[model samples]
Target: MTNSPTPDQPRVIATDAALAFLAEIREDHPDILFHQSGGCCDGSTPMCYPASEYRVGETDVKLGEIGGVPFYISGSQYAVWAHTQLIIDVVPGRGGMFSLDNGRERRFLTRSRLFDGGEACPLPLARG
Candidate 1:
């Protein structure tokens, strides 16, 4: 059950491969969140966790939903990346040790492109 982005252009989206992988992951853990982790040797990589397992922090910002799961990042990171659209893709590799994609042999990756002129900028802060 993928959720479409609202009237505001989405800040994040998933590739078909990523959506397929996310669907498989959803079978076991029905509720999850994709968090864009902060920097540190790929700590910036996105991590998937069961919704109940991880708590969203104060500065966490909900970028948007991809494949029905809400995607998030720190407000500071959002500030740095607000002009880009996050593209989630699936790749062959071990996922983050703490991310649900771990042990699956395929992991989620983030790619981005700067929004073209005329697209919306600066979405509401701290939206989750």
Candidate 2:
């Protein structure tokens, strides 16, 4: 039996294509995680990295999980994106230089939709 996310549980969702891509990469790099940047070098795309390699800091917020992968957002960025649901998908292009998906000719992308006034707000930070 598959364990799907409850209605109010997931703050993030991954497309089938994105999940397939992540599965392929996980074979080589098992401990993988995603961090959606607000905007910078990668233009706010969902960047994938080895779990131990990327350091989640005090300002980061854990939105939830997608495909069993924990997704985080920088606190400063979270403030701006708090009202929406994050949609993680894959597309044809080069990912961030530091991201594991780089050089694969396909990159993880972030698409969002408003929360319909029912979904929970952004997950709280560990400390204010």
Candidate 3:
């Protein structure tokens, strides 16, 4: 499945790595849910939740699901992302976890690997 964001919003790109990861998981778990949470310093972090219990954030960009997995973007923060295309890639480290990249080389890992079977790396909170 596929969906479009707002007219002014840039297109979201899912990297091959991301697709492969999702496909592997979907083989056993069809109901996969993807979402983003606001991070520290004006950045965002992505998370995958159980399909049975997933909530969409106000600023999330809805990218239709593939292989029964739903995908979304950070609506408010996405605009500020340097690269229009967002690529999800797996970080090369212990505990196999994924990260989000904005195509420009900027990357952010999940706040806690507990959510996605990886190590914990909390994103800095955005200051006022």
Name the candidate that leads on TM-score. Answer: 1
lDDT of 3: 0.47
The candidate, 2 or 3, that scores higher on TM-score is: 2
Best by lDDT: 1
**Each model's lDDT:** 0.87, 0.80, 0.47
Query: Pairing residues by index, what is the TM-score of model 1?
Result: 0.90
Task: Report the C-alpha lDDT of model 3 over 1-128, residue by residue, as the tens digit.
Answer: 22333343323345566567667655665666666555563343556655666666565666445335566756565445423444455444332134223332333333211122222122222211
- Per residue, candidate 1 scores C-alpha lDDT tens digits across 1-128 of 33344458888988899999999999989999999978777744799999999999888899889988999998888888988889999889999989999999999999988777657456776757
Per-residue lDDT tens digits for candidate 2, residues 77-107, read 8888877778889999988888899999999
TM-score of each: 0.90, 0.86, 0.51
Sorted by TM-score, highest first, which candidate order results? 1, 2, 3
Any runs in candidate 1 off by more than 4 Å, and if so which? 1-7
Alpha carbon RMSD to native, model 3? 12.9
Worst ten in a row by lDDT for model 2: 1-10
